[model samples]
Target: MPQRPEELVELLPAANRFLGREAEVGDPTERRGLVLVHDLAGDFDAAHAGALAGAHLLAALPHEVIARFDADSLVDYRAHRPRMTFSGDRYESFTAPEILLYALEDDAGSPFLLLHGTEPDYAWERFVAAVARLVQQLGVTSVVALQAIPMPVPHTRPVTVTAHATRRQLIEPYPVYWGEMRIPGSVSALLELRMGEAGVDALGVAAHVPHYLAQATYPAASLTLVEHLERLTGLHLPTEALREAAEAHRTEVDEQIARSTENVAVVAALEQQYDAFTAAREGTDLLSGGEVPSAEEIGAEFERFLADQDRKKPRD
Candidate 1:
């Protein structure tokens, strides 16, 4: 027998309360409609920036779990095994993986939804359909995904991002850097694609983490993600804690890099590239000379670029 989409999730009574209370009092136009923010696919995130952002919001805001997904049916235990504490010969405790939906209140007392935790390992289509059903039932109007990717950028420079949306107008202010390319996919990416096909407003940002710090905890990237989330969703989110952590981490990283002349030289080279690009922001290309490559030149270079991007490589 095949599995049904409805079986994938269990909605709690609190979800109705979330809708019922809003329906009773708020003005129609004042409602921006609920925004569903997700940080799924743990391994896909560079430096776990998306997870950090979701965690920060949950920690800072008042929230409650409104729905739970069937993790056993979705997650592969071998890939992301749950932790077990064994004392002597007996097992004391086990930390199980879960996919949960949280209803939260931001600093301004506005309500929103967050889907956090493990991404599914199987039945992506069914999982996505289940979410779409929930979205309709919960009155969510837009979806925003939080992500981070390693880039050849410098920590000394301000963080930048690749902004994308289902509709171009949603992110008209952001620049488009790439033409067309096929890359590896994750469940979260698929969800965004399908949501757009269903005519829902979907947009997201992938903060550019310095490639050297891709495997490490980079609060700066997470902070940048939160800031973009605020601007995109019209939600007032607090970032003071993330800001403080980023500053402390920067000082620590700078001190470490200063100890190595080779590392310092590498960072200095990146800074030069970053500065050159900033000086010519109005220009189209990254080259400071302002020379646009021909179609043939771009194709050849892009082929070489594709060769360098092995998904299994140590650095992105």
Candidate 2:
């Protein structure tokens, strides 16, 4: 669907607020390059990991807020209840929604923009257009948005990422999507599409999260995103914190799988399917003689195994 003429210009006011704080943004020598956006979306809390990755970068680089969005118009207060704390005799303030634009610089002194926001419940188009306008004003050359999606893959296999971009050259290294797919829309998706239409370069990287680990914090995916960004933008970004966390999480997951033979079997089966899929994508004939299992079949078997394990567990 195309946006109305008024919707495009109406957001300029909010976007102008993004450029007004240049003094607080960063060093004048750092030239604006890319804009990284993270909208809390999908399963596996990958959005949280992406946000933490952004935060870690901000900690290492000089950064400041460029703009702030009004939560009252975008958020549903009832769904996100702010917690109140008591300190001494005074009541502490509630935790409000944080929808912010941050101006940051990398180790190479190339500046970039990072936008982190709670997925809005209202006026998504307006919010997205406002961000696009801000990107144009900031002289950002490219936009990279991060998202993590749950797939029927195993944690034992290396995490795969799907790249979407306005131009084919930007994602030449990644596998091309051939089939038509439809999923629930997100602000990040809209922003990328609108930016592309506005003649701005935009790319989206979707980290594949194992369906079973969708609810867990997977720092491995976070580390992968940081590394990919470095290669894409040629900017050195920090990933030590996420790396350490990923190693610890890997150990925990391994121990849990070791406890259950069923889990181990399921993982092994999934690993085979993953390897076959990988080989196929690489234009290999590794699975020519053997039968390649469908993702649905693998996912169904794992689900049954989990159900059986749950039923056998002692109830409280």
Candidate 3:
């Protein structure tokens, strides 16, 4: 079991170029303009939007694994069991969990880093430290965290996002929603906070997934996330496939909602709320715009809905 941050990850030969190492690791005065994007897989991600966006990037671009984290030390097997194949009385094969860092080239041949895989079940602080070390050693200029969150939003409208950053200027175009509220913590959020404290530029985008469809796959949210990433980082990523999936998903969702009068009423009410907030364009949240359920209220009402989705989920 690796106990130290340096030991937790193995940097492959492919990573040497980023380390400013020709014969040995040394600091370079020149900026490499490297960006690191991390999307740790966990229940915190509503509708698995972050994971899908990361997957899409890997599929569309050229990349290579640069580092491999010690998953055995970080993961709790009982919490997320590994997959194994069985045939009668014989065990055939087992698939292990992975936390990998990849070095990828954008469409314009610009280089960046991507850290993706299951969220750690242990040693979160150490894991974060290890990544921080990598960011400094590999000359990463910025770190971006991709996330998805449930909100009282309607699928009929364009997807919305909550953008955040360590510094105000990094997310100047984004609106400031609420003052402060306590919520469940996730590793990605913590990383952003810590990175900010370290004087390193870190930012994140939380795509709003409709609270009602939080349990189901929503490609629109994923597409929106990727689009925002492109906007923020100037990365030319392919979104055609995700766009098609979202379009097809919208039609299916509409057909299903049309069958249920209750569901239709719910959507209409949400749409009205959405439109009112957009028209008035208040600094306050949608809930304060008028007498409609707030995102927090709707989320609380549907809390029970997502609870079982995790309990019923099969071991990884």
Candidate 4:
């Protein structure tokens, strides 16, 4: 039987035994920032972005594992069945999810903490409590959450980022979301909310992904997240890898659009709507009076167009 969340939280300190081959160095005391990159809610673009950032951060910075959370308590193993890699005819090994805490340093020797792991299936409160305590113990000045959301935007346009923070000061001078939205909750969302109530500074960066490409590995979205992090935290994180990946992915997507006139038309229509909406933001609230094309309407049109194209394809 899987352990309960609270019970799992109790085992965090000793969870290092499950990290497989990854060596865990003890925590460093100089950490100043905390970045939360929990992969839940099944948003692939956000996951991709987090992965890219994590890779660069780990490669360029000095880091050590400070804490490990119990996967038995956090993950729903039945849903995410552990995979067995085939070494030979009958040899195999189990691969399990792990939650790890790392103390990292940037170019200027500034300290930061990265909490990278799978989002738990239960015990949200317990998880938040553990993270909050870690934040306080590490003297973390700010907590930043990274995510990507499917938006009614176009790929041809600049990616838009929706910013929010527990304290207005943290996200000021950036585009803030005031519209009432009811998104499915994520671990990072709850963590930020709990931390805010406890007076810890918390900020959220949501990269706006095109509805069509939300399920794909969108490196452009990843780059946007990294840029926002650098702007907010002065991390000096490298972006060359993400940049190259983005260009390649863009070319691939462009090729797909070129295959069908319907696809090209769909993209053009989305671009038009996006440009108008963005221009309206500078003057009046175009979204309030329903004067513009509804995001749902635009998305439906895009979907219908793609479906029609699929239906016309000759099956082998």
Best by TM-score: 3
Off by over 4 Å in 4: 1-47, 281-316
The per-prediction tally of clashing pairs is 0, 1, 0, 1
TM-score of each: 0.86, 0.77, 0.90, 0.77
lDDT of 4 by residue, 1-316 (tens): 6444345543234333333212332444343334543433323234355555565667667877767788777787765556778876875787788777776767777656777766676777888887776665545657887777666667776666767789888877674444554445667889889989998778867776676775567888778777888887777677788888889988999999889999899999888887776677766432211113445653464455345434644464
| Candidate 1 lDDT score relative to the true structure | 0.80
- Residue by residue across 1-316, what tens digits does model 2's lDDT show? 6443234332324445345554245664453455665545322234355666666677778877767766567776665555688899999787877677776778877667777656676788877776766665566768887776665667776666767889978877765534554445677888789888988788867666676776567877777777777766677777788789889998999999999999999888878887776766675332111223345653454455345434644454
Q: Weakest 10 consecutive residues, lDDT, candidate 2?
A: 284-293
lDDT of 2: 0.66
Q: Candidate 4: what lDDT?
A: 0.65
The C-alpha lDDT values of all candidates are: 0.80, 0.66, 0.84, 0.65
Give the per-residue lDDT digits (tens) of candidate 1, residues 1-316.
6579889999998888756655564554444479999998455577788999999999999999999999999987776768999999899999989999999998899999999998898899999999998877777889999987666778887877778899999887777765776556778888889999999888898777777787788898889889888888889999999999999999999999999999999999888877776776755432112222234543444344334433433441
Ranking by TM-score: 3, 1, 4, 2
Error of 4 at 144 (Å): 0.4
* Alpha-carbon shift of residue 38 in model 1 (angstroms): 0.6
Candidate 3 lDDT by residue in tens digits, 149-225? 77888999888887889999998777776666566677898889989999899998988888888888899989998
lDDT of predicted model 3: 0.84
Worst ten-residue run, lDDT, model 4?
284-293
lDDT of 3 at 277: 73
What is the C-alpha RMSD, rounded to one decimal, of candidate 3?
Answer: 3.6
